[model samples]
Target: MKTLQQSRAIIATAILGVIVSTYALYVEMAAESKPGYKALCDISEYASCSRVLTSEYSKGFGIIPKESALEVPNCIYGTLFYCFMIFLATFDHIGVNRLQLLLSLVSCASSVYLAYLLAFVLHDICLVCISTYFINGLLLWLVYNKNKQLVEKKK
Candidate 1:
């Protein structure tokens, strides 16, 4: 894709990621505050977003200790990541593209770990979580394509 087209695609994907992440954050907070709160994404007992969001794995990617200061919700990380992606996409420089590609790769790796937890460990299907995973994968593809285009242009 052309640089302009690639940038637009990345921006659009990041916007979707932001929206989904924001909703996940809202669900996380609302469920924490209100007792018996059920999110719209909470479809069923086995496929409950509330259950997944409220789980131990939802914060700090389930890697950081809960007592640690850096143990924030994953949605917060998701929000910041998409925002950073948007910022990086706004700059069309090769270095900026490289950074974007690297970030996307990292995000995808995180998604893989989270997905494993969701399926085997958590044993629940969270729509919101799945959506973010899909978004992350899409962003990785878009950023990778953009980087490949950039490299080919230099040939």
Candidate 2:
């Protein structure tokens, strides 16, 4: 069984994720309107959220799936991903031992890759994106520890 604190942490992180991703999506959409517009997230040259967002990789795997036919903001995917995490946390076990841990690992892995792209490939940092990545990493850590606690309790 997960602890109350663990559950609360998960819920809080999910809520934060939703807020961040929604703002990111808003920035993305707002860009389509104004030509020279920049989001408040665009803090500086090295850490320009808007520039990183407009990069080719921002479309995410949709680039390969849609074959560039569609360009969906990565924020949409992040929002949905966090929503799923919240749902799972609220519903309890996913009928598979350590499923939540597995999911977190996958999500964190994706975040790591994206962070790499932002840092090394794109040569720019996105404040909003970095914050989301941090949240996901924290969520993964919390959930992983909770999974360990569950295993220990069973023994």
What would the TM-scores of all predictions be?
A: 0.97, 0.87
lDDT of 1: 0.92
For candidate 1, the clash count comes to: 0
Scored by Cα lDDT, where does model 2 land? 0.78
| Model 2 C-alpha lDDT per residue in residues 1-155, reported as the tens digit of each score | 46557877887998899999999888877776777787898778898887777777778642456555445788888899888878777644434326767877887888888888888888997989899989989888878767776667667
lDDT of each: 0.92, 0.78
Highest TM-score model number: 1
Candidate 2, clashing residue pairs?
A: none
Candidate 1 positional error at 128, Å: 0.4
Give the Å error, residue 87, model 1: 0.4
The TM-score, computed over Cα atoms with residue i paired to residue i, of candidate 1 is 0.97
